[model samples]
Target: MPLRLGAFVHRRIIAPGALASATLLLAIPASAASYSPGAPGIGDPYYPAYGNGGYDVSHYDLRLKYQPATDELEGTATLLARTTQDLSRFNLDFVLDVGEVRVNGAEAAFRASGEHELEITPRTPLPKGTAVTVVVRYRAVPSTKQAYGFTGWHRTPDGGIGANEPEAAWWWFPSNDHPLDKATYDVSVAVPDGTQAISNGTLQSTVSRLGWTRYNWRSNKPQATYLATLAVGKFDITTGRTDSGVPVINAYSKDLGDNYGAARASVERTGEIADWLSGYFGKYPYNALGGYVPNTTTGYALETQTRPFYSPRQFANGSNVSVVVHELAHQWYGDLVSVAGWKDIWINEGFARYAQWLWSEHEGEGTAQELADHVYASHPADDAFWTVKPGDPGPDNQFHLAVYDRGALALQALRNEVGDDAFFALLKGWPRKYAYGNASVAAFRAYAEEVSGRPLAAFFDTWLFQPSKPGVSAARGASISTRDPGTKGAPGRPESWKKIAATNGVHEHPER
Candidate 1:
C-alpha cells in the first residue's frame, strides 16, 4: 500500500483598496508566439519529468477493459485539454506500451521516449489556448513501481488499487502525472460479469453485455492524477448518503472473515465523520464519499479522491475511527487543496494528521494540545523525527514519522501561537481559498502569517525546517512558546459551533 501524501496552500489576500476601480493589463503580440515543443516536465525539483508542460487538461474520459484471469488490461484515455503554448509537439507521462496515438481524431506520430515520456507530434501546430483532444490506446499488464519512497500501485488478490502518490499515474495510464495538473474524470471499466469495479466519484450507470459488466464512474470535481484509483474485486458493497446528501459507497472483500464485520462498522461511521468534517472544514469537496476494497494486503490506507482505500490493519481498534477521520479530512485538505510540489507534502499529511488529533480530542481521548505535547516530548534530540523536518524532507524520506506526527505538531504549535480565533479561521480559509488548485510551502507560510496577522518566520523555521528537537518544558506550556497570550487557552476547549461559524475575515467558497 502507498502512504498518504499531502495537501493545501495558503494564498495571501491583498485588499485592492483604492486600486479596485482601476483596470489595467498588458496584452501579448501574435508574432511573439511561436510553435515549439512543450517541456517534458513541470520543473518540480524532486521529479523534474513527473508531469508534462504546455497544456492544461480539463477532463479525461477513460474507457478500459480488464481481464482478471489473464491479468491484462486494454485502455483508451481521451484527454481533453487546452494548450498553453503553440506546439508542434508535446509530451505526456506514460510508461505502458502504446498501440496508437491520435491528436484531434487523426492518427498522429508518436514514440515512447525514455522511461515515462511519450513524445507526440501532431499533424498541425496547436496554437495557444486551443482546445485539443489527445487519445491514447494501449494494452498491457497493469504493473506497480516503487520510487520516491512510495509504492506506485498495490496489487491486490483479486485485482489492484492505484496508490500512485509522487509519480505512478503513468504506470497504469497516460496522464499529466502531477498534482499541478488536475482534471475532471469519467472512467468506465469493463470487467467480468460477477466481479465489481470501482473508481473515483459517483457511479452513473452500469451496463451488462455478453460476459462483461461496465461500471461508469464520473468525477465532476477536479482531481490530481495520483488521487485517482481503480478497484476491481469480488466484494460486498453498501451504499448510502451523508446527511448533507453526498453519496456514500463502501466496499470490502470477504477474505477478511470476522475482520469484515469491523470494516462494515467503520464504513457505517463514515457518514457521521463526513458530516462533521464538512462542517469543520467547509462543504465536502467532491461528489461522493466512499471507501473501496478494504483488504489487508495494502499495508497503508490512502486518501484516494472520492473514495479512500483502507486496510484491515488500519481499523485494528475496531470502531476507533481515527483512520476514517484522517482519510475523510483529506478530501478537504488533500483532495480539494493539493500540494504544488512533493516537498510541501507536510501541507497534506500535516492537515490530515491534525484532523486525526482533532477526532481524538472530540472523542475525549485527549485535546490536540495534549497529543501534540506527548509526541513532541517523546522525541529526543537525536530521534529520526528531528532528523528530517517536514518542510524539506528529501524525496526518499517522505511518509516518515516526521511528516505525519511532527507535521501535526507544527500545526498545534501554530494554533497555540495565534489563538483559536485565527487558527480556526485559517482551517476553513486555507482550503476554501485554494480550492481545486495547487499550493506550496512558501504560500502556506505567507498565508498563515497573513491570516494570523503575525510574523511566524521563526516559528515555522524552528518547527518545520530545523533538524533538532526544540526545547520543551511540560510545566511552562507545550513545546513552542507563545509570544502573545491574548486571552485564549490551548486548542482543546469546547467552543460553540456558532462561534466557530462566526469567524470574520475568513475566505469561504462563494457557493457556501
Candidate 2:
C-alpha cells in the first residue's frame, strides 16, 4: 500500500439474485451430518467481508490469457487447499463471470453472491483436514468490473495492470483475498507477441507461439493476495543483482515521457537500496528484489511483494528514492510480515516511513532524530494530525498522514526511551520472528516490551492511542519538546527535509 491522505466512501453494488442465493446457502440443516457451509467472512473487524473461511490455501496456479484490444481476461485458476472444517460449501472472493467450477474433479454448483463472492457447493462435502484441489474457469473484462465503488484493474494503452491495496485479487482472480491466508503462486499470463507480462518472484520462462506469448512466473514464498501483481505492457526491462546476489529486475513503461529518466534513476537503485535496508532491517526478505514504473495516473506507489509498483508521479520532480525506500521497507514489514488486520497498518506504513528517514540520514540529508523533531515542531497541538491515532485509525483514515509520520514519530520516541541496542535489535528481530506470516499491533507492543525489558504501555498509549498531542514530559521520551502553538522551536529541519516533504508528503486524494 502507498501513502496518501483522504477518506474514501465505499459503495457496494449487489445483484438482485444475490441476496436470495446467499440466504439459501446460509440455511444449514441442524439434523444433517457434521458438514456445514464455510463462513462467508474471515472476521476482520475493519473489513468483515474481505476474506473467506473454512479452507487454507497453499498455492494458486493461474493460467490466464488477455486480449488488450477487448480488455477481456480469461483464466483457469487451480487452488491447492486444506479444509479447516467439514464444509458442504465454501466461498472465494471474486467478481468476474465464472463459467465452470470443479472440486477434486467433480462439478460444483456456484453462483454470484453479494459484490465479490463466488458461492460454491461441492457435490460432496469436504471432510475436515482433507486436502482439496479446486479448479475454476472464468472470464471478464476486468476494466468494466467494480466492487466497493473502485476497480483495482487498470487498463493501460497497451494492456492492463492488476495492482491495488487491501483488495485487488478479486478483480483478476478468485482468491481467499486477505493477508491472513498467505499462499504461494504460479502466475502464467499469455499476451500478444510483442507485449510482455510481469509478476512476482522469479520469471521461469517465456514461450511464444504464432501470435501470442506466455510468461510464467513463480513465487515460492507464501504471499498475500493483494501483494500478487500482474502487468502486461511494452516496457524497457533491466536486470541485475545485489552485491549479495539477490536478483534485481526493474521495468519501465516505454510510454513514459520525460519522467522516464527520473523513474529509471530512482527505481534502478532498487538493488542498492535493498542492500542498504538489509543492514538495519536484517536480510532482504525475498530472493528477487526490484520495482516497476508503469505509465499510470495513480499518484502513489505500492509494495507489491517482490516487485513494488511505482506510479510515474513519484518521479515527476526528478529521482525520488524516498518513495522507493518507503515501498522497499515494506518488503520487510508489510510484505514479509503482514498485518493481522487492516488497522495494524502502522506496523507497515510507519516502519516504512521511518526507513525513509533512515535513508535520509544515510544520504547525509538529515538524521532520524532531526527529522522527528522537525515533524513534531511543524505540527501544532491543535492540528488534526494528532487526532488520527496511528494504532487503530479507522478504515477511512488508515492511509492518513498521521498514520505514516506519526507512526514513525512513535518509533523515534521508542528509540529515545529504549537504548539504541534494544531498539535496533527489536527492528531486526521482528521480521525474523514473524517472517512470511501475519501479526497485530498488540503483538508488536508485547514483543517490544519483551525485547526492551521495559513496560511500554503508557508510552505506546500516549504516542499511538491518544487523540491529543503527547505531553512533553520526561516519561513520554526526549524526542519531542514543548512549544507554543505555531512556534518554530530548537533543532530546525535540514534543507533536504523540504525536498523529502515535497516528494513524499501525504496528498489530499486517496491512493489506489
Candidate 3:
C-alpha cells in the first residue's frame, strides 16, 4: 500500500450522516483511497504556523514588477517542489492578495487563510514523492510590518528594500518561509529604466524595452527564505572582482550625494575583507561576493544570503568596517551553516560577534581573550544580560544583548578550554562539515567536544544554560592562562579612521 494511503485510512474519511446498507458498507473497506490535507504548520515551537508541511520546495522562480510612483508590487512566483506525502491540499505562506493560482498548469482552488498562509487544494490528489509545480500571481503595495523587528518589503523615499528575516518572506512571495527548507532562487525584477534592481547571487542579465528595465539574478546555492532579498532603487553600480579574484558587484543608492563617495569606499573594502576572512575562517563559501545596498529607511543591517543589506544611517558611519565584518562573517556562520530553529540563533550571532573580535585582533586593537574578559568584567552580576540565556531568549527579545554578547563569551570560554590550535580547527571544521545546512546548539556542543577530545558539558552549562554569570575560572577554565586587560593598549579610533570620519562627517566607534 502507498505510505499516505495507510496513514489516511486510520483517520476519519466518511461522514456519520451517510447511511448505507450492511451489504453496501461491507462491500468497501472503511478506509478507502483518499488523500488528506497537508499539515498546516511545520511544528516549530516559537513559530509553529509559519512554515507549512507535506511538501519540500526545491526552487523558486520569481518575476516581479514595481512601480515606485504608485508603491505597487506585482509578482509571479513559480515554485518547484516535491510531495513528502500524499497531498490533497497544502499551504504556502503569503501576505499579498493573489489573483490566480495553478498546479501543474491547471487552475487550482486556493484561499487566503489564517495568518500569512495561502491554502491551496489541487484538482487531483498528488501522491507521495510526486514532483509538483505551483504558480501564484499576486499584487500589493509594498509595506513593512513589525515582527521581532521592523521588516518585510519597505518603501524607501525613492525606492525600496526587502529586509524579510524570520517570517516576513511571505510579504512579497509565496514560500515555505522557514530556514530549514533551503532552496535556490531565480529572481527577475522590472523597474523604471532610470532605477536599478538587485537580488542575490550573480547578475544574469539586464534588458531594457520602452520605459522599463528588467534585471535577472540567480542564486544557485541553497538559501533560506529569510536570507532571500530584492532591492529596487536608483543606484550607482560597480561591477568587478575582489582582491582574491572573487566576482564582486556593489550597488549604492545615488541619494547619498557627497556621502556617496564614502559609501563607495566602504563597499570597495568588501573584497579586501573577504580575503582577510578567508585567511582565518577557511575559503570564501560563495561564488560571488558583494552586496551593500544602502537604504536610509532601514535602521539596521542584515546578512541576506550572497549579498548583505545595510542602512546608510547606521552602517555608513566610520565604524562600518567592524559592522561589515560582523555581517560578512555571517556569510559563513548564518548564511552557509544556518540555525535549524530560532532557538539556535546563537550559533549565527555568537559566531559573528567572535569574528568581530578576531578582526579587531587582526587589526592590532585587542585579542579575543582580552575582549571577552573585559566584557565579562564590565557587566554586573545583576544585569539582564546574564538572566536571559542565548539558547532561548523568547520571541521578542530574540536579538537581545545576551545572544550577541554572552554568546560570543561562551565561544571564548570554549576556546579557553580547548586551546588555540584545537579551537581554530573546530571553527573551520564546523561550517565546512555542515555547509549549506542547519545545526542546533546541542549539535554544536557535541561537535566541539568531539573535536577537542575532552568533556565540556559543565563548561557549556555554566555559561549558556545558567541565568547567572559564572566565575572567572569557570569561564576561562583551569588550563588557560589569564591575560591582564591593562597590559593591552586602551581602545581608540585610529588616526587614519579619524581622518576618514572627519572627511565623511561620520564617527568610527567599536561595538559592544
Candidate 4:
C-alpha cells in the first residue's frame, strides 16, 4: 500500500512586466545555431515535469556522506549517459545547494529554474549519440525542503530514511526521475562508525576510516529512479539465503519496541513466500530477496526494488503476512516490469493484490473464485467504487481502494473467461517478456488476447473502463457465481471474505 499524496503542480518563477518573455528569450546563446535546449520534461501526461529529455542514463555512481545529528547530506553524483539529440543544455530533477557541475571534465554553467529542475549548460554542444559524463557536487538538509506541498524525506530520532512513492530521489540525489528511463546504480554512503546505511542490490564492500564507515551497494539490473531507496540508522540486521539460493537480508530499527516480534514473524518468511510466488511468476527476477521495517509514523509500505520498505504501523496488530505477500509480488510486477506511465498503475497494483488472493487460496482460507464472488456480491449496483476505471484511474484516485480490490476482481473475471491454463500462462509469461523494462495496459491487453486466442475488448471494457457496475449478464458471462452452491437461497457472501476483509483494513497516509 503505497502512499497516494496530493497532485504535484510544477511551479515556475515569472519575472514581472511584458518584457519578461523577451528578456528570457535573449538569454539564449547566439552561437548555438544548430543545437537547441532539451525539453525540461519527459512528456508524461499525468506528471509533465518529472524526468528530462536529450539523454539516456546508463549508470549512476553516487558517493555520499551524511551526519544524522546535523541532518546534512553531501554527495557527488556521476552519471554515464548517451545523448538522444543534439543538445546545448539539459535538466536534472534536484533541489539542493550545488557547488559545482562538470560535463566531460569541463566546468558547466548551472541554475535552478522550476520547483525541481536544475538546468545545466555544457561548455560545448553535445552531438546526438555521443557518450557523456556528468558530475554534480551538492549538499542539503533534505527535511527542510518541500516541493509542491510534499517532502519525501522521513526524519527519525536516530537517523533518516529516504523512501517514498512517485518521487524521493530529488531529496537526496539528482536523477532523471521517472520510470520511463531506468539505469543501473552504484550507491556508496558514509555514516558514523556505529551506524548502518542500507540501499538496493548486493553489498559490495565496507571501509571504515577515522570515525566513519562507508558501505557500497550495487544493482546490476536496470532500475527505475523512484524504486531506489536509502535508510540510515542503528539496526538489527539478519542475513541468510533463500531455498533457491537467492540472498535474503532483513533489517529492523533497534527502537521498534513492541512491534519488533510481529515484524520479524512476518518478514522472516520472505524466502518462503518468494519461493511460492515463483511458481506462478516464473523464476524470481532479482538476485537479492528481502525487506526492511523502519520505525516511521507513515502507515503504508512501498515495494522499493529488492528490499521493500515497511512501516512499523503495519505490524501494530500482530503478524501480517498478507501485506508481505502484497509487497513481494511487486518485485516482479512493479519493480522488474514497471508501468510505462502513471495511468497504467493497475498492472502493478492489481497483479500484486491478485497474488494476495492466490496466497489466501493456497492457505485454504478461501478459494480465488469464492473470494471474487463475495467481493462482487458485497458491493451494490449503485456503489461509487465501480466508477473508478482501474486501467486508467486518474491521478487523484491512483491509489484508491478500488484500484486494489476492484482491480483484483477484474483479474478474477479474466481468469474465468480465459480458463486456468491460458490465464496461468499469461501470468508467468508477461514478466518474462518485459523483464527489466516498462509496459502499458494496452500492451498487456493485446498480450492477453494472443495467449487466450479470444477477443477481450468488450470484456476488458466492461471490467476496466465502464463507469457503472457491470450487469448480471456480464457477471454470468465471466462465470462468476455470486451465491454459495451449498445453500438453496438468494445471493450471499462467503464467511471467509469477511475474515479477509477484516484483516486488511483501509490504510491511509498520515499528514506529512
Which candidate achieves the best lDDT against the true structure? 2
lDDT digits (tens) for residues 249-361 of candidate 4: 89999999999999999899999999999999999998887888888887788888999989998888788888888889999998989989999999988888889899889
Q: TM-scores for all candidates?
A: 0.84, 0.92, 0.88, 0.91
**CA RMSD per model (angstroms):** 11.1, 8.3, 5.5, 7.3
Model 3: per-residue Cα lDDT at residue 282: 82
Clashes of each: 2, 0, 0, 0
The residue-level lDDT of candidate 4 at 308 comes to: 90
The lDDT of each candidate is 0.75, 0.87, 0.76, 0.85
**Two-way lDDT contest, 2 vs 3, winner:** 2
Give the poorly placed runs of model 4, Cα more than 4 Å off. Answer: 1-31, 482-512
**Which whole-number lDDT from 0 to 100 does residue 33 have in model 4?**
42
Candidate 4 backbone overlaps, count: 0
Q: Across residues 105-196, which tens digit of lDDT does each residue of candidate 3 receive?
A: 99999998876789998877787788999999999875743333344777877777776557558767899888888899999999999988
Q: How many backbone clashes does candidate 2 have?
A: 0
lDDT of 2 by residue, 72-165 (tens): 9999999999888778899999999999999999999999999899999998888777899999999999989988777889888888888888
Location of the lowest summed lDDT over 10 successive residues in candidate 4:
1-10
Highest TM-score against the true fold, candidate? 2
lDDT for model 3 comes to 0.76
C-alpha positional error of residue 44 in candidate 3 after TM-score superposition, expressed in Å: 1.5
Sort by TM-score, best first: what order?
A: 2, 4, 3, 1
Ranking by lDDT: 2, 4, 3, 1
